[model samples]
Target: MTRVQANLLLLVIALIWGSAFVAQAQGMGVIGPMMFTGIRFLVGALVVAPLAWREWQQLNAQQRAPGRREAGKITALGVLMLMGAAMQQIGIVHTSVTNAGFLTALYVPLVPVLGIFFHRHWPHWSVWPGGLACLVGAFLLSGASSLQIGVGDAWVIASALPWAVHVLMVGRVADKMAAPFCVASGQFFVTGLMALLWALAFEPATLQAVQAAAWPILYTGVMSVGVAFTAQVVAQRYAHAADAAIILSSETVFAALFGYWMMGERLSPSGLAGCSLIFISMTLIQLIPVLKRRYS
Candidate 1:
C-alpha cells in the first residue's frame, strides 16, 4: 500500500474507534460499565484468537523469532489495558463522548513523560510545554474552576497514565517474543477476566442486561478491537510511523463529530479551545522527533 492509502486506512480505523465511543456510551444505559467492558473484551478475544492462531502457524512455517510467548509482558500489558479500558468505560457514562475522546488523547503527551520512569531518559524540552498545554486543555474540557473538576473528566484524565503505561509496555516488548495477534488476544482476554472479577465484586449484571447491551458490545468488540486494530497493524507496515500517528490521532476529531451527530453533544467555546490545544500537543509530540532527526 502507498503511504496515502495507508493513511486513508488509518483514518478509517480512527473513524471506527471514534464511533465505538458512542457504542460504549449507549451500552452503559443498559449495563454497568464493568459488565459491558468485560463482555466487550471477551468478544474481542474470541474474534482475535483465530487470527493469533494463524499468525502462530505462519511463524512456525517461517521459523521466525521464538514463539516463546512472553507471559510476563503480556500480563503487564493486560493490566495496563484493563485499567485504561475500565476508566474510559466508566467515564463515558457520566461524560460526553466528546470529552472522553479528547481527554483520552492526553496520553499522547503523557507517553514521553512516562518514559522517564520506565526507560530512565528524560524527554525533549518541548515535551514539557506540550504537557502544560494538555493540562490547560483538559481543564477547559472539564469546565473546571481552579479547584473543581467533573468526576467523569477525572476518570478520563486518570485513564491517561494507564494508557501511556500500556503504550510504553508495548514498546518494551514489541520485538521480544510474542506474535502481535497473540499479544492482542492475551490483552483482551486478561482485561475481560479482570473486569469480570470487578463486575462480580461490585456491579450486578444479569443475562437480560447483557442481552440488552448485545449490539453495542458487539460493535465495540468486533469493529473497534478486532477489525480496526488489525487494519492498523497492516496499514502501518506500509506507512511512515509519524504519518500513522497523525492520521490515527484524528480519532478524537471523529469522536467529537460523532458525539455531536449521534448524541447531540456540544461543548462550550472554552471546551473547543481545549480540544484544539490537546490536538496541538499531540501533533507536536509526533512531529518533534522527525524534525529533530531531519535537522540534525
Candidate 2:
C-alpha cells in the first residue's frame, strides 16, 4: 500500500475506535464490563474465524510443516492482544471517554519504552520531551485534581501498559504471518475465548441485556474489532512505526469530537488545551527521525 492509502486506513481505524467509546459506555448501562466484553468478543470471533481458518490453510499449503514455534508465536501475540482489548473495555466503563481515549494513546509513546527490554535501544532524545508533554496532557484530559487518580483513570493507565505490550508483540510477530488473516483470526479467537470464560464464570448471559445493547455490541464487535483491527494490522504493515503511532493517536481527537457532538459532553478550555498539546507531542515524536536525518 502507498503511504496515502495506509494513512487513510489508519484514519478509518481511528474513527471506528473513537466511536467505540460510546458503544462501551452504552453497553455498560445494561451489563457489567466483563460481561459486555465477553459477548462483544464472542461476536468478533465469529466474524473473524473464517479469515483465520483460511490463513491457516494457506500456511499449511505453503510449508511442509508450520512448526510449533510459529504457532506458539501467533498464540502469544493473540493472547497479548486479547489482554489489551479486555483491559481497555473494562477501563472505559469506569472512565470518561476523553480519559479513555487519551490514556490509551499513551501506548503510542510507551511502544518505544518497551523496545528497551527486547532490543536494548533507547528512544531518541526528542522522545523524552514529547512523552513528558503527552503525560501532562493525559493528566489534564483525565481531569484529575490534587494528583489524586480516580478508579477510572487508574484502570485506563493500567490498560496502557498491556496496550504497549500488545503493540510490541504485534510489531514482532505481525510480519511473519499473513497480516489480515493473522490479525483477524488471532484477535477474534483469543478475545472470544476469554470473553466466554468470563461470561460463564460471572455473567448470566441475559437476553435482555444483550437485546438492550444490541446496536452497541454489534458496532463494537463487528465494526470496531473486526474491521478496524484488520485495517490497523494491514496499515501498520506499510507504515513506519512512528507514523503508525501518530495515526493511532488521532483516536483521541475523534473520541473527543464524537463525545461532544453525540453525547453533549463539552470539554472545558483546559481539556481542549491538553488535547492539543498531546496531539503536538505525538506529531513531534513522529517527525523527530525525519528532522534528525535532515540535519545530522
Candidate 3:
C-alpha cells in the first residue's frame, strides 16, 4: 500500500484505541483486573477465531507446519502481547486516560531504540533530543510533580517496555508472516487460555461481573480489538511506517477529548503542555525521513 493509505489506517486505529480507554475504565468498575482482561480477550478470541482459523488453514496449506523454532517464536510473541495487555488494563484503573494514552504511546519512540540493540539501526541523532523531550512531556501529562511513581503509572511504564518489545517483534515477523492473522490468532488463543486458567484458579466465574460489564466489554472486545485492529493491519499495508506512528500517536489526543466528553475529566495546563510536547516529539520522529531526504 502507499504511504498515505498506511498512515490513514494508523489514524483510524489510533482513534479506536484512544476511545477504548473509556471502555477499559468502565469495565474495571464491574470486574477485577485479571478477570476483566480475561473476559476481554475471551470476547476478542471468539470474535477473531473464525477468521484467524481460516487464515491459519491457508497458511498451513501454503507452507510447512511450524517447526519448534517457529512455534516457540509465536508463543513468545503471544506471551509478550498478553502481558502488555494485562499491564495496560491494570494501569488504566489507577491512572488518568491522558496518562495511559501518553505512556502507552511511548512505545512509538521506544521501538527505534529497541531496534538498535538488534539491527544496530540507531535512530537519527535528532531522535535522542526528541525522545527526552517526549519523556519529560509524558511526565507532565501524567501529572507527576515528583519522581514518585503510582502503582498504576509504574504498571503502565513497565508495560511500555514489553510493548516496545512487541512492536519490534511484530516488525520483524511482519515481513515473513501474515502478521494480522498470526498476531490476532496467537494473542487471542494465549490470552484466552491464560484467562480461563486464572478464572478457574482465582476468579469465581460469576456472571454478575460479566453481566454488569457487558456493554463495555463488548465494545472493547469487538470494536476496539476486532474492527480497529483489523483496520490498522489493512491501513499499514498502504501507509509509511513513520506516518503510521504519527497517526497512531494521535490516540493521546482522542483519549484526552473522550475523557472530557464522557468522563468529565479535565487536564490541567501543565498536563496539556506535556501532552503537546509529546505530540510534537512524535510528529518530529515521523518527519525525520522526510527531513533527511530533503536536506541530507
Q: Best by TM-score, which number?
A: 2
Q: How close is every model to the real structure, measured as TM-score?
A: 0.76, 0.83, 0.82
**Residue 61 local lDDT, model 2:** 86
lDDT of 2: 0.71
Model 2: lowest-lDDT 10 consecutive positions: 140-149
> Residues 1-296, candidate 3, lDDT per residue (tens digit)?
66555665676777888899899889877777677776776677678778767877887898844456766776776688778877887898898765675677677667667778766776566667666776677667667565446888788888888877765665455445655666565665677678667666875657887899999989988888677765655565554343444456567667777988999999999879977886787677667767788998
Clashing residue pairs in candidate 3 are 1-238, 2-238, 3-240, 6-238, 6-239
State the lDDT of candidate 2 residue by residue for 1-296, as single tens digits: 87567767887888888889888889888877766776776787677778777777787788732456756776776677667766777776776765675577677778777777866767677767776676677657656553435787677777777767765566446665654666565656666677668777977667887899989989998988778877777776666554555557667667777989899988777778778887787677656776788899
Candidate 1 structure, TM-score to reference: 0.76
| Residue-pair clashes per candidate | 0, 0, 5
Which regions in candidate 3 have their CA more than 4 angstroms from the true location? 64-68, 87-109, 149-156, 230-249, 294-296
- Candidate 1, poorest ten consecutive residues by summed lDDT: 238-247
Mind giving the per-residue lDDT tens digits that candidate 1 earns over 29-67? 888888888888889889999988897788778887333
Clashes of 1: 0
Candidate 2 stretches greater than 4 Å from native: 2-8, 64-67, 85-106, 121-125, 149-156, 240-246, 291-296
Best-first order by TM-score = 2, 3, 1
Worst 10 residues of 3 by lDDT: 237-246
Shift in Å, residue 74, candidate 2: 2.8
